[model samples]
Target: MKDRFDYGQNPEKTKGGELIAAYLCDPETADAEFLLSKAKYKAITGREQKKNADILCYQIRQSFLPGEITPEDANRIGYEMGMRWTKGKYAFFVATHIDRHHIHNHIYYNSTALDCTRKFRDFIGSARAVRHLSDRICLENGLSYIAHPKLHSKGKFKHYGEWQDDNRPPTFQERLKAQIDSCLAEKPQSMAAFLQAMVSAGYEVKHGRGGVISFRAEGQKRFTRLRSSTLGKGYGQEDIQAVVEGRAASSEGRGAPPRKVNLIIDIQSRMKAGKGPAYERWAKIFNLKQMAATLQYLQESGLLEYEQLEKRATGAADRFHVLSGQIKSIEGAMSVNAELKAAIMDYAKTRPAFKGYEAAKYSKKYLAEHEAEIALYRAAQATFRHVLSGAKLPKMDALKAEYQKLAAEKRAAYRDYRAVRKDMQEVVTAKANIDHLFGLTDTQKNKEQER
Candidate 1:
């Protein structure tokens, strides 16, 4: 049975309450607010308590396989997952809707904690945590779980959302890549010939210092670099030359499948199926090495046990949020400083016109001739009236210095933010890897339970 889970924050508390009320009104569902206490009033309380919290509520959807789960069972699973994940910190409401062929649960939880001390942080991999918990719950209840093979693959790959939508027109790079591939397929005699063919295809090519080639497709915003890294290695200069001179075949059809991260090797299961004694020995050694590596990682992180690892992970997540808040505060200050500096400079620059108009008032002919100047001066005065509020505009130099100070502060904050963010990612990744290993072990245990 395949299950899908996705969540998004609700910025408006009233709107979130309305959404929950609407879901509860669904005809197929009864006892909509299952396992919830004062669900209707929590949204109001959440808004009253946390005035600055943008994410007042989080809307979560848990969809189950069609006909696999009844509405009652789905509601139970949803409530269990919600309570388990929230840890009684946040108030939540769950509604089961069988409006479609499949049974799905709509859950809305308050962002603020019950004690009004902490807020629910939707940190990195938090969604995956929900999914993992949900899957485990499904396995416990004798229901099948969908395995996401793509997620298990190695490297930073494009997710389902990141993939190019077929409904939209081809991307600039895609079109250019296709054109380049087409040119290469014809087998040009030289690199120049390939360039000529690209030009004939209505592409504007510019060759720069150090063999840097850039192409500007028609109606494209900016020129795209034709470097080996930008395009695939097969479209590089050497590859192009090889194709042109008929020395080498095109590697387009020969691209290898993406390598997977097989850190959690199920060698024992493979050996148990029909492997030899040598394979068993190797598997034993591999498992021992992995266990040692895990222990070393925990030791370095000062986390001796699983509970300590969990606490450390939470601290890392909190640190990331703190760093993010600092960066945002710095950026906001910098923007305000920049805007103030620009306004001050503009007022100062218009002062000369105001002085010129005042001096020219003695000459009636000059006043009539330079009416535009007087109008500009009046406009500047009006702007300064609104901006400075009866006070004189500050000197441009002082405003500039303030802006520079803010800019420097922002830069320093950003540098620190980057370092903290990197550390947070490392901690989060280590936690995720450990969780994945534990998940694999849980799957094995589940299989044993099934047998």
Candidate 2:
């Protein structure tokens, strides 16, 4: 809680916390006050407060497009959103941070009620409700909200950076469709001629059993069936045959955009896979073209020397591992924190039932009455005993703080993770291409000797 509030209240980010506005709590003392409410709840109910009992507070981040709203206005809007959402039943503070190009608010509200008797229960569709509220508040303050939100099929929302990467390299199926379209454009007179055109364009065509046609692109392990089921409508084998026989118009203007660089082919590996002289020739030419592209990529990246390229590839790979390790470590801590929190909450909720059963002198009737609760209580106790192992159970505030800190670190690391992963892929691909071009592998060297 302190970490979150402090980050937002960074002197550099929020102009020494001047942009902070609080209701029913001081910004500096909010964390303490929030913790006190939890304490009060425990005292009032005689139920132990567990690290994972109910949420101590909820945070909502409201961000404005660069230069869209002033820091003060952003804070006010955030404050309004919190007040309206909680209906002033909970205490909250809004801290507007202007550290990035976007001005965003960190609104933290205590989950425990002002009276400390009940917690603000999060309901289904709370996210949507808050979004709607935020949008309404934004409009009332003369700010814009997302008028049309795009839905992801997987139910995971994409961040701006992820959306920016949508224009990536086409998939294998898309490339094949494009290739088939290119073959059709040649106006082949027969299916045989169309297959020949595909071969000329570096595809290996196979006439399978039952007249099934398939094509394998360079570096592809499996042949893709030329069927409507696989390639979608209008690009099937029958569709191509129809176009070839002039029975139907060709599917026009479909192909992958030219790629900036292509990976080098493993010619020796292809030959060992029973490729003929024709395939060997095509493979050599493909390798040469791709090697040139790789060289250009290296030159542009300032890795002209083979040693420099190797060093870069190794460094990129190492850096990727380090970032991955950091993320994994953070995730591991988070998992433990979450598990402990849930266990604590379970223990606290079932403690009363277990106590009542004990008071009944271990009677089977009482046990039968509260079997589920008593069992859950025992399980939680066992978990604490196993995990803590005589160590003191950390305070709920400390655990929350640790989890928040870890979460922040994870987010920061993930941003670097994406960039480092991209760098590693490019540098590693460049190195592999260089190795293939020079026939650095033993198999390639043997092929060279045989020739």
Candidate 3:
């Protein structure tokens, strides 16, 4: 799960930035987790899913509360998070959130520490690497992970890594409202009590106008106006009806749970064996989400056909795959010389490992100097046998020659381009010099001479 949490100051209590910072960053704090963005938050996801979100902050908090602090207490929280994660060493980068709904903590940390240093280490320049770490942290901490390509608002739905902001997940309040409303009826007695009841009943409550409480339950809305008339008048028609209707209106619990969403990666993990509710929740994390749909809607702006989404996704995948394959090939090529050198060194270090039994004391380090060509020779012999036995394909000397020829041609082409560029510069200089001289000479009748 990937998540960003806003640890607030109990609203009625003192708001201290230092305490939150100290708690979150204090290398020794426990029960803490971090999130990279609010993209998949109930605040974000619930809106599109159920029509609204229920988040309160988007920035890091600094107090005794958890998950909302930073550098001010690094070592303490580092050790704390590390111990809970059961990994030695940890590192998390703090971020500032400008969104006011939630004063959240964005955590980017590692699960394991360096074996050599025992201190958490990270590749500071890699966002992808950080995402992996962020995903791991979310799962371990029961947070949600967001996949990239955030969905857009007014477009046909896009898939993973394709959605823009318009199709993003529901906002926090929406989700909160839904969870609160699940199999729940709004209690008009008091807003706070109504919210508390909803929460206890596994619903996330949202306050509406006229003291009305609105929430979503099983994909539908359940709203009721709050009033003191019922209590003061010893229950009116609506109240009498509510008591009679609330029971009749009470819905059967789905008996399942919410799904786990990976907004950043557009992935949903399976529920653990014992976590029934979670399994139900994660089961819903599918290929298509409103965020993606929203993006698709925005992109196409008309009734969508299945083929278009598939086509775009397939093309994008194929292109990325090609790039991935090329990268792998380049990496292999870069390692060739190193591998050849290492093989030669290995042959020298342990000559007996091969057919050659050179019996002389030698330094282990000698392997670094000579094993490559030796391996090549051995390979050639194997190839010769393979050809003789007719059990394997014959070696391609033509291919080798062609490859070397291409390499040489490439080098030559580069040299030629450089030479041509230099010559062009010389020509330009000569022309400039001629112009300077002619200007001093003052040939005023050049127009007629040209004709």
TM-score versus the correct structure, for each prediction? 0.32, 0.44, 0.22
Predicted model with the maximum TM-score: 2
TM-score ranking of the models: 2, 1, 3
Per-residue alpha-carbon lDDT of model 2 for 267-333, expressed as tens digits? 7877999989866765665665567667777877999788898889889888999999999899889
Question: How big is the positional error of residue 229 in model 3, measured in Å on the Cα after superposition?
Answer: 32
In the range 228-265, model 1's lDDT, one tens digit per residue, is 78877776767667777887776544443321112334
**Candidate 2 global Cα RMSD:** 24.4
RMSD of 1: 22.3
Residue pairs clashing, model 2: 52-341, 178-255
Q: Go through the candidates in order and give the C-alpha RMSD of each one to the true structure.
A: 22.3, 24.4, 30.3
Cα lDDT computed for each candidate against the true fold: 0.62, 0.80, 0.37
What's the distance in Å from true for residue 60, model 2?
0.6
lDDT leader: 2
Q: Give the TM-score of candidate 3.
A: 0.22
Report the alpha-carbon TM-score of model 2 versus the true structure: 0.44
The TM-score of candidate 1 is: 0.32
